[model samples]
Target chain A: MDSARDEPVLDVRGLRVEYRGDGRSVVGADDVSFSIGAGEVFGLAGESGCGKSTIANAVMRLLKPPAEITAGSIRFQGRDVLALDGRELRAFRWREIAMVFQSAMNSLNPVLTIGEQIGDIFTTHEKLKKRAARERAGELLELVGIDPGRLKAYPHQLSGGMRQRVVIAMAVALRPRLLIMDEPTTALDVVVQQEIMAQIRDLQRELGFSILFITHDMSLMVELSDRMGVMYGGRIVELANAKDLFAKPLHPYTEALMNAFPPLTGPRRELTGLFDAPRTADSCGFHVRCPDDRSDCSANIPDLREVAPGRWVAQSAQGAP
Target chain B: MTHPLLSVRGLTKDFQVGTVFSRRRVRAVDDVSFDLPAGRITALVGESGSGKSTIARCLARLEQPSAGQVLLDGEDVLRTERRRASQVYRRKVQMVFQDPFGSLNPVHRIEHFLARALVVHGHPATGEALRELMTTVGLTEDMLQSYPHELSGGQRQRVAIARALAVRPRLILADEPTSMLDVSVRVGVLNLMRRLREERDIAMLYITHDLGSARYLADTTMVMFAGELVEGGDALAVMDAPAHPYTRLLLSAVPDPERAGSYDPVERARLREAILNPTSCPYGDDGTCSRTEPVRHIVGEDDGQPHWVRCHLRAPASDIARRVLKATDDTEKAETTAA
Candidate 1:
């Protein structure tokens, strides 16, 4: 908690992103703002197309044509991340902040051996010779708990879990200070998912790196994150400690999202449905689906304000303490 | 105890892997058996490559089993149908695949899918019938006019389910139906399946890797591992006190926010290593689990609901140990001769 007061590892403020084509623009993220402290695991959660991934892409400068960061600032280690040019950005990316996308293991080149792929990172970034890079690649594989002997194996030869570990190993080879993992284990089975998450936690602890974890799995999000933000219609509606958000979610949408998970040990309850509507600039983004939305909710867009110490909620009138 | 709507016996499927010159047989589903009663949901839970989906495909007749009996209403359809499955058998058994994006034809509207399903099964594809099918799955009738791409993941899955229901299937085999959908939309689909069982008495075999959803929606649950049924019983009873070591490992691995900061990575690794390895049987000294098929052992029965486990730990009273020892001796002799 004390780290929250210090210089944050990553800070994003007033972030806005849009997908534009054919003379029309659709908001992908609206005024999103959050920060991760040193060694903190800050989780961003929303359904697909709700702008969680958009924000991640925006921060990584991975946005392409038709998708643009309309407004915002991303600061990494007190430096303007968006201001970094070609080489600076490339150097900043894997060396300072690394990103692991959904099904990253499947993205690995099938033609190359695990050692060759991992060695390429060192040879390209650090300008290390082939033999030296290969040695370091084996160590990275060992760090992620895969047998170093399998470094010579191709991606197709490794199991899905082992391939995922290889990706994680490659991502942290440079010991980046912050790691962005988006649904890192969604494609994995429960046992494999647990193993991967445990390995990630251990890696973070050993390397002292912050993580910007993104996923739609609420239970996994709560289990891993120190703080979390709930997104709806491309806007963050709630931000608080992960445990507090799970126990007492102030926003109605967050509460509904929590109830949607089928419990393993409880009486079965009827799950509610989430309504999807185009976002309106004048109203709160979640007003259409919010169960407790009032007239003011549609009349005025509520800003994300501090409703309690270290807790933030975006709602009209009733959000006030 | 009336007869179940669907009963599978000794289901087995094998796939040939490796190059043609060096082919190896991999048993995907081995001697699996289960029953799905009318108006009840039976969940088959397992990890990837654990034969859960293979079982579903066998039931749907999408794959020809190496050897098995698929009895629908006390009739063995495998023996009856020679070449392809009869249209009546296809109508009685329908399948819902995992990926909605892949399952539904993107070029065609939702109406085409449902109407064709009805017409192919000898049912009248009227506008009223289509509307009824849409409403039955809790989707609006207007959605039928839209293509699969226009709908959300959840909506597409519902459309897939609606198409399956349009034929009035006696047993629906859903293989990881909601796994691809978001967490918020997943429950709505599960609720619809539960409603279908209650309203239409449709027996369902829900195949999934998610233990939580199985416990939530299933009346009976069966856990599978490496193509074998490891544990099975009443859903609540099995989930509460899982009998097999594999089931217990799966349950412990499930993500629970309530159990934060209490993850024992070392213990998880040990359990996983012991269960997932193929060469060593964790509970036995002779590698019996790797070599021999597990025999069912009734561990407990409560209120006429029997809980059974198929593990070496539960088969101590049986003569399986002696038989495995004898088999191990013969295998040793054969290996020496081959060498």
Candidate 2:
């Protein structure tokens, strides 16, 4: 781990986001904070509407209207990203921090050739000539394992996996210090997902770039991340090293996620717990469905605290250690 | 033992791929057969273009099979008249799709979906009985008024399940039912299916590309490749022993935290290449696999039931040698094709 004093590649603190709805505000992210070191893969895992994606958008300064970062600080490479003006933010986007969205197939322009889409990145950031940009585009495609000669083909001409590679190629066009990928392989089949993940791992190793990988797949997160943060109901319920988190997940929600996925190698058993009724308004977010819920769970909202070395957990009705 | 609930024999489907005058035929689903035993889940596992979905579609009669028989309770439905087949088959087998959102109509309320199935299959004579079925699937009476878009993914899936149950079908064909759901919510849907199987004895054919879920849900698992069942038997045995090379490759590719640092990219590539190779084995003039084809070898006895595998490695020495030579030639062809 990098020292606390050293400048981190991406630092976020006291971050809170809200979605205004029907004269009331819905809490998307409440007091979330974390930092990523250089060449680190930070995983954010949660069920749908957990606000992990909202936090990523907040960091990127990409949140749409009505969904706003109500409070927080986002610093990229020691610069205040939230404080940047519109022109500065535009310049900072691809040059300093790039994004690879979930639907890479749709993210690329269908009409444009793969080379032109990638070339746009260099032209926009470096103000390169058309010929120079085309040359650089070929090099980027080659880096991602696509043949340079095939760059003239349109997006639809390539397979889903190849289009994802093209999106990755474009994201790293400027060699950004940080890359954020949202559910990058959720749409892919298992074999194709494995291939894409392997490519991502190799690129991270070679480029030494920091990544903020957001996905709901717990097993994938454990395999690829250095550190993992578990989110629930828009709160960071648990954060720890990948191995430690899987081995001994402190939060109730984290433990539930571990139990949900069947063991990859094991005897067959009829696994259950698929239909959990939603929690009542007064109860804790997990209380209604939690196997170990107590009466006190309905009344208190748990705060995340450091329970052990580099491990954090939410306070439960059973009380903190 | 009693006869299987659903028995398929020599199922085949072919598609015309190229231009009009010069036609090119693609054998999308070759001669394939399997059984869904009474009160048990069977998974048809494979990657894309492996004819897994085509098999499912044929079983559902969504696409007309070019040949072979789909026997529901010993009656050859494909041979039956089209109109009568729809009536009988619709009541016996219902399909749950991969996308929960797309399965339900966007404009209609949740109750309308369930009501339509119930009325079609002749159920819920009164409003009270209709609401009772809604509660049976864990949805409150209030949710009946909400549109499909208003519900969460998990809720929408439950509605889909409830719609299937409303028909009170003998068999349920769930095609990647929980693949689109959240990780936490996926278990909920799987558990619901298990409960239905136990309480109602609804035989399920759970088709999925995810082996982890297949291992969890299936009683008997069939591994499909290029429109053929390469390996099958008890789910536990197939997953644990995994006799075929393709089955082993699938198992190894699953993301496990325990084996994080042990994966080799080159090995994965080799396995992928092996799966993609066409003409790995020769079929006879009648389109049946040849006498030299890999035989189904019983690996071991698991809980008194025999575990089976279909691979050249498990076959006799002569077949193995033939397959080895064929594999070598295919590698050369693959290299030239890539070049």
lDDT of 1 at A61: 92
Q: How good is the docking of model 2, as DockQ?
A: 0.58
Can you tell me which runs of candidate 1 are displaced by over 4 Å? Answer: A1-5, A21-23, A281-294, A316-321, B261-294, B312-339
Q: What is the DockQ of each candidate?
A: 0.60, 0.58
TM-score of chain B of each: 0.88, 0.84
Q: Write the per-residue lDDT of candidate 1 for residues A228-266, one digit (tens) a residue.
A: 999888889899999999989887878877767777887
lDDT for model 1: 0.85
- Scored by TM-score, the top model is 1
* lDDT tens per residue, model 2, A1-321: 355237789998989998888887778888898999888899999877788889888888899879988898999888999899999988888778888887776888889998898888778778899999999999988888989998799998888988998898788888888999999998877766777888998898888889999998888899999999998877788999988999887766787777678776756565554225443346555765556544455554476778878888777636642
Query: How far is B304's C-alpha from truth in model 2 (Å)?
Result: 5.0
Candidate 2 per-residue lDDT over residues B214-273, each given as its tens digit: 888888889887777788888788888888877776776677888764445566555444
Against the true structure, candidate 2 reaches a TM-score of 0.89
